[model samples]
Each structure stands twice: as C-alpha cells, then as structure tokens.
Target: MKAEKWVFGFIFVFFLVVTPIYWFMSGEIAGTFVLGFSALLGGMIATYLGLTARSFDPRPEDRDAEVVEAAGPVGFFAPQSMWPFWCAITVALIFLGPALHQAWITLVGVGFGIWALSGWVLQFYRGDYKH
Candidate 1:
C-alpha cells in the first residue's frame, strides 16, 4: 500500500512536469488544456488518497467472517460441443464468399455463423438436461 502510494505520487509528479514541458515546447492550446485537466485529475486523486489513508478502519468481524455452505453444486457438466468448429467454418465462408462476390452465399453463411456461435457459447450456461 505504501509502495502504491509512492508510485501514484511519482506518476502524478512526472506527468505534472512532462505536461508543462510539452505544452511550452508545442505552444498549442490543446497541450495546455491536456496539462490543466491532468493536473486537476492528479490533485483530486491525491486528495482522495489523503482522506482515505486518514480514515481507514479495521473491523474484527470482517477479519474473521464465517463461511456459509452453498445450497447445491455450483455448476452442471456440459456435453461436448462441436458447433464451435462449424461456426468457424461458417465465418470463413462468410468472409470468403463476400470477397468472391457471392452475396447470397455470404448472407446465408453469416446467419448460420451467428446461430452456431451463440449455440456453442451458450451450451455451457444451459441446464444439465439441455447440455
């Protein structure tokens, strides 16, 4: 935590120094605006850290909280999925077909591609019976 504070402080100060140098060298309004906004952000962040550091508390109950058993098993075992391979083929077809100017073929491939992709991805989230 102390290291994190020092790192943030170093970054804040480094940015403060770099921004002004960049602004002066470039003589651009955008650079100045960026510098100003960065300084404001740094100040706000420093203020937040200062306040949080001064007000932190350790709770005994939180330190030694009780663990509760879950009502049931966490997840179901999903069946093997082959649709991912099919979706990959369809996606390849969609790209190749369109590049070859086969509009109808591309459209059909894209539709099936989306369907196969969703079915493949969502199979894991289904109930045991569905899987």
Candidate 2:
C-alpha cells in the first residue's frame, strides 16, 4: 500500500507539472483539462491512501513476501446471473434515447433501470434461507 500510494503521488506530481507545460506548448484546452483532471484524481487517491495508511495492515506485497503468502480470502463475488446484461441494456437505452432525441426511450430505460436494480439486489435473496 505504501508503494502504491507513492506511485499515485508521483503520478499526481508528474501530471501537475506536465499540465501547464503541455498547455503552454500545445495551447489546447481539451488535453490541458484531461491532464489537469488526471492530476486531481491521482492526488485524491494518494491522499486517500495516505490518510488511511494507519488502518491498513502491511500486505505481503509490501513486505516482498512470496505470492502464496497473500493467497487468502480474496473476496465475495456474485454468482452468475442475467441482471448485469439487462442492466447494460438499460444503460444503452438511457444514452441512446438522448442521442436519438426520443424522450420516450429514455423514460422507458429509466423505468427498466429501476427494475434491473431491484432484481439484481434481490437475486440472491431466497425467503427463509441463506442468500
């Protein structure tokens, strides 16, 4: 985590220094904004990591331990389900409606999005049993 934090910190500083230099050289607004925002995001992450460092235990990677030393309790992942696909379709509809100037499509997409969200949240829920 320390190393990761430093890497992001470096990114923040590097982009911070480069953004103005880039703007002065190219005089382009879009690239300047991108670089500047990149710096902001990097700084945010580095700050977050730095602030939380005290609560975080040193991981195997930080100690340069073997990979097997870190192999434990990865995390929970949802089982297979079609809700994700349905959710993607709803997002497409949401964007497509505005793009095509059809308010009805966007409304439908929003409605379906609510349904998809509920279904996805409750997919693992089985009454009177472990989910």
Candidate 3:
C-alpha cells in the first residue's frame, strides 16, 4: 500500500506538471484533460491508500521477505452463478446500439442488466443460501 501510494503520488505530480505543457505544445485539449483527470483520480487513490495503510503494520512484501504464510487466502469467495453471463449479454446489446441503429434495444438491455444485477446481489437473501 505504501508503495502504491508513492507510485500513484509520483504519477499524479508528473501529470500535473506535464498537462499544461502538453496543452500548450500540441494544442490538444483531450490529452490535457485526460492527463489532468487521471492525476486527480490517482491522487485520490494515493491519499486513500496512505490513510488506510497508516492503521496497519508493514507486511512481508513491504519488508522484502519471502514468507509463505503471507501469501495465504485473504477470504472465502462466493460460488459462481449465471448472473454475470446475463450481465455480459446486456452489455453487449448496449454496446451494439450504435451499430444496430436501435437505442430501444440498449435501453431494454440496461433495464435487464439492472434487474440481473439486483438479483445477483440479493441471491443470498432467500432459499437455500439464506443467511
């Protein structure tokens, strides 16, 4: 986390310094905007990691150690389900909106995607998986 924070912080500073120069030299607004926005987001991420890492002791990786226990599973993961496939289908339909010349299909896909996402999120609320 410390390393991440420092790397992102460095990138943020580099972008901040180069954005104006890029805009002035190339007269291209898109690249300037992208660099500036990336810097802002990177800075935010660095700040979040910096603050969060302050609460914990350094890890084996931070100390450059080769400890096997440190590579253990962090937590259990949920079993896979079919909602992601449906979501992918919906996204594909939405992505093809312009090519298909049909916005209605995209809108319907968005609705279906939202419904599928909700079902996926609440899957454990009932039935055999209830908790």
Candidate 4:
C-alpha cells in the first residue's frame, strides 16, 4: 500500500504539471476542462486514500498459522460452456454489422448475447446438493 500511495502521488503531481503545459500549448476550452477534470479526480483519490489509510490490515505475526481445509468441493462445476463461444461470436457481429449496414444482424447479435449470458447465469443454479 505504500507503493500505491507513491503511485497516486506521482500521477497527481504529473497531472498537475501536464495540465498547465496542455492548456498553454492547446489554448482550447477543452484543455481547461481536462485540467479541471484531472484536478477533481486527483483530489477525490487523495481524499479516499486519506480516509482509508488506517483500514489496511497488517500481516499476522505468526507465519505458520494452521489453515483449515475444506471437506469437499464448494460449488457446482459445469463441464460444458458453449455460451462463451456464442457470446464472442455475437460481440464480433455487433462490431462488424454496423459497418456492413446490416442492422438486423446486429439486433440478432444482441439477442444472442443476452441469451448466452442468461444461460451462463442459470448454470450456477443447476447443481445437485452434495451434502
């Protein structure tokens, strides 16, 4: 977490320096917006870090703590998943369909994507009770 703090500090400082350089070079209203946005983001990050600094848990003193092992596998393991393949195909079509002016193909892709996602979700609930 010390590393994270340094990283955030560096980013905040870098943005502070870059904002003015960008504003001077671009001379555009968008540069001002970017500067303001970056400042706001940096402030928020700093605030979060300040508030959460004490919440980080330190490592345990005993390095050889006994860990309890589970009796068996915890959850369902579905063997087959064609849904992912279908979802990937759907995404590809959604990306390329608009360029080809195939609106219907895009709609079909969206439908297929939804269907695949739903099937994947339902698979979690289909396990037998092992106990």
> Per-prediction TM-score, please?
0.39, 0.82, 0.70, 0.61
lDDT of 4 by residue, 31-124 (tens): 7778767876876677677567668653232233334432346675667667778778889978878989989889988988898888766765
Clashing pairs in model 1?
Answer: none
Q: After superposition, how far is residue 26 of candidate 2 from its true place, in Å?
A: 1.8
Worst 10 residues of 1 by lDDT: 58-67
Q: After TM-score superposition, what is the CA distance of residue 31 in candidate 1 from its true location, in Å?
A: 2.0
Instruction: Identify the runs in model 1 with alpha carbons over 4 angstroms from their true place.
Output: 57-131
TM-score of model 2 vs. true structure: 0.82
Model 3 is weakest, by summed lDDT over 10 consecutive residues, at: 75-84
lDDT of 3 by residue, 99-123 (tens): 7999988898898889888888888
lDDT of 3: 0.86
In model 3, what is the error at residue 118, expressed in angstroms?
A: 3.1
Evaluated at residue 100, the lDDT of candidate 1 is 92
**Candidate 2 vs 4: which has more lDDT:** 2
Give the alpha-carbon lDDT of every model.
0.72, 0.92, 0.86, 0.71
**Model 2 Cα lDDT, one tens digit per residue, 3-76:** 98999999999999999999999999999999999999999999998888879788887787998998989987
- Candidate 1 has an lDDT of 0.72
> After best superposition, candidate 3 residue 33: deviation in angstroms?
2.6
Candidate 4, poorest ten consecutive residues by summed lDDT: 58-67
